[model samples]
Target chain A: MKVVYLDNNATTQVAPEVLEAILPYFHDFYGNPSSMHAFGGQIGAHIRTAREQVASLLGAHPDEIIFTSCGTESDNAAIRSALYADPEKRHIVTSRVEHPAVRALCAQLSGQGYRITELAVDKDGRLDMEQYEQSLTPDTVLASLMWANNETGVIFPVEKAAAIAREKGILFHTDAVQAAGKIPIDMGKNTIDMLSISGHKLHAPKGIAALYVRKGTKFSPVMVGGHQERGRRGGTENTPSIIGLGKACELARQNLSQENTQVKKLRDRLETALLNAIPKSRINGDTEHRLPNTTNISFEFVEGEGILLMLDLYGICASSGSACTSGSLQPSHVLRAMGVPFTMAHGSIRFSLSIYNTDEDVDMVIEKLPPIIERLRSMSPYWTGDK
Target chain B: MWEYTDKVREHFLNPRNVGEVENPDGVAEVGSIACGDALKLTFALDENQRIKDIKFKTFGCASAIASSSALTEMVKGMTLEEAQKVTNQDIAAYLGGLPQEKMHCSVMGKEALEKAIENCLGVTETSADETAGHIICECFGVTDQDIERAIQENRLSTVEEITNYTKAGGGCGSCREAIRGIIDKIQFEMTPQTAAKAKLSNIQKIKMIEETLEREIRPSLKLDGGDIELIDVDGNRVMVATRGTCATCKAADITLKHFVEKRLRDLVSPDLVVEEVTQ
Candidate 1:
């Protein structure tokens, strides 16, 4: 059976054009971009062109795009730089539902004496603006927000948040790893001082990402020793992968308008069929603001892992709410943060679509999934007669 | 997913005698969602005190659900007394063996059975009396005097070695210091430093090791119906092979780690590692 790949939120398959552009760099055109020799100077020109392509996607200046290893590294650099820029200020503000990369980093910083205020979100995974406003003080140095949540696919008001942070004179950073390619982002139009983006979330390979730092922003390098990215990010460039990311960004920008509409329709059809065929199954986040290509739902009484296993047997790729933390058995922290009850939390699953998905793929999923849920629910002890 | 044994998967997927008996002679319930699992056990008792039918309803992980199912299957033809002796280890052993972390699920089954038995007796099950005159282990506040007498009477080797005989020091490990205190006091009184000068012969040392194992370790394992055999004697370092209920028990490592080693080290020599001889 052909596998239906629906875990785009976790990562996306590299686009064909992006892969073709990157292959030449690995063998025939291989050269050190920093090398002064003619053989290497040609590769350095490709790097500049790639940077401009990525910059165009985000409406950022080519100089603002500083390549990093991955989204987490970019988030780390941005948050750490904000702290370094204003050492006297000791407060940071962020949301409770941030991905572990940001959440864990903030948690570690909190232990090191930074007073972090984790703003709470409402049931739809939207943050409270009132709490965001109250969290700011003279000591607040940064407001780190995410453009979109990886788990629920709920979009945050990043532009409004940047405006708020600007009024407070606090630097704003966004982990836009999930939003960069899926949605329209114009950093030039927003008040965002810094933003983080990853390659894997788009149609680019892993291990390459970038941090966009607006010009004239007070910046400090978290990683020292090398002069790469103009001493802003210090690491030997991952030439092939970075080149792939740039090409992927260009393709995503080219096809985004049409692919977004097509993928959204596929997602909608899948959601509609599953909800109609199964009782008590509904979307988990605000439908209107959620990513057009992602859908998270809960099937009451049936556990997510059990359904996932059955789906796995049929060659379907998906994600569940269970997080294997070092030796503790608990449901997802994200679902729990949203105040989802334990009974329903274990039943939540995420299906993130990509441009590679098709109407037939949606139809196959719609045809195959309800029976799997029905089979698992039949064996569940908590199943009510309504099901 | 848990790497469940074939037997465990079979029991969980097609669990035996699930759901409650309409009119049960006795009912036993233990654990709750707070503890991550809960079981409701019901039994149909025969005139001869045999279990005519056994049924259970469990809301837990796969191992927990499987343990309950396997327990219900094992106890149907057993007398109430025989069923009472069917320990958590027997439940785990019946299902090929559970992972160490899921050992608590099998234990929950035993607790539910015992609770059902106590319920059948119509006397409120005695809470393991928290505020009492009996002093166990000072480390975990297990009443020393009660647990000490139980240890002497029951022949317990180590502290977790005693959880089978007495549910102390199993929570938070605060009572271990108190247990060590008592063990030190007893050793000091029994083997006074002068006894070391008396020169324990190699035969006597070996006999002392045998006595400690037979008296202390075996009985504790028997509570779970597990047994251990002496593999070889090498001065203070002893090798033992766990068997029966313990051979495949998940906490068999915990048994060897905290209990077996501590006992042999205290009774035989301080240099004992208590290595397990596989097969």
Candidate 2:
């Protein structure tokens, strides 16, 4: 059927090289890195090397990276731990467009006597720096923000936010799950005290993520148990996935430049064709400042789920802004926060590219999508006028 | 991947009768893509009052697309009267079975067929005037009397309960207030002065839920005509039985979690939990 996958923001297929790197740990190299046996000691060396590989990608020291279960876990740990690290400060500043992993958790914290200031974003999904600056207070303990939005792919000014927070002596954490592999990130120079990365967002398997706590930064362990990652995290090490993530990070560092140029061009080509071919279609975020491999577009008078189903029929995978959460009738909160009209919000579709996607795949979507949208619009009562 | 039945898979994979018919005798459409689906039905009527051909174009999920395909194939050689009688249930039965939430897909087909018939007859596709006036379930534009009768016919128990029989008030829910008004009107009409003297009874509430389900919610699911079973009764907690199509629907969770649970809780009991029975 010649399936074409474009839903990279949701999750990515494991890369062959990353798979090869992880296979050895599953078979002959299986051993607890914490044990005193020779086999365990040998595997411990491999774990150290993997740690270095991941650290190199983020431009952090080897001891700074602590592996977690996933991006959500890391986000929870970072935000909650920041408050614990500085108990006197009962205020937190963040943006409204953060993933539910952060937003929902923050909302939960709001019930526990913590004052949260949610900064607003512009219509194009860009955070308002002026509003962010004004929201900061002496009581603000942490400024947790995302490097890039999952739904819109709009890049946030992490460096600026970190600098502002550092000037105020407030700790900063950036959920870089979507930005880690797709963009150039040098955490060491950004004043970013803490950062989070998810393996599934790249090509490593799900249930593997890492938290980057810069050396000398105050951090409290969210999980309490064993002395893994120097007690920063607890539980038996997910050796295979950790190793996979390390390999994925190394690959990311190697291919990031090529991806920025080549993958970005492919994504742009797909966006251009879609916007040119489909009537009443417009891009959802700032095209110039988004992730190289991501694009979101709204097809007016057409619902996202229907468009997604049509694309599914053609063996083209993507995501939508329609009711992103499990049960809510409303569309994506990111779009809603951007003040996007309800009609347009429901019609938005996200197409995220990866190194694996090709021109032929984009061409297939370009060929198949217009007729589907036109056909759907023809039946729409709301789209009575010329499209 | 979902375990789609061979019939469902076939309809989804190689959908029958897709795309719009060019300048047809009559075109009937429902469920726009924005509403998660849209259908365009074109039919040719013969001199003998039978349908010569029926073609459809649908933009929706697998169930909706498949239901429309199955429906166009099912009604090709039937008379307008016979086609009008072809319910979403009949469509689901023909396709072996559909999931419960997808049942709305089949109901969409029935609605399209009815609308097509109305279009063919040179009449403005008005609401049925049998025992009902145009007391549309403003949320989804379903009539009042139709809801009243559906409640008596289907034994519906709650507002979410009605979606299984009729697809009323299933839209944006702006129509629910109107539905409530209609319910009170029907009750008052049933017992003139007693309406003012007596409080609305539990039986009356349950009856209203049944009517809403049959007239409004059910028809929507019937588009795919997946069977929804009434599981059990525990005080206000009504356990539903979803089989055939609904038994394995992906959004069956969504149907049970949001649509079914919310509607029932809002209209009948706020503490109700419309749980899906594990197979």
Give all candidates' CA lDDT scores: 0.79, 0.78
What TM-score does chain A of each model score against the native chain A? 0.97, 0.98
lDDT of 2 by residue, A1-387 (tens): 878999999999999999998998888889998889998778888878889989999999989999999999999999988999999999999989999888999899999999998888889988888888888899999999999999889999999999999999999999999999889889767899999999999899999999999888988999988999999899989999999999999999999997789999999899999998887888888877899999999888766766777788889999888742222334677887888776677778999999999889999999999988876665444565453
Error of 1 at B194 (Å): 20
Where in model 1 is the C-alpha error above 4 Å? A323-327, B1-16, B26-38, B43-76, B85-104, B107-110, B113-268, B271-279
TM-score of each candidate? 0.76, 0.72
Worst 10 residues of 2 chain A by lDDT: A322-331
User: In terms of TM-score, how similar is model 1 to the real structure?
Assistant: 0.76
Give the clash count for model 2.
49
Displacement of the residue B274 alpha carbon in candidate 2, Å: 21
- lDDT digits (tens) for residues B44-110 of candidate 2: 8777877777787665556666788888888888888888788777888888887544555677777
Best by TM-score: 1
In candidate 1, residue B150 scores what lDDT? 43
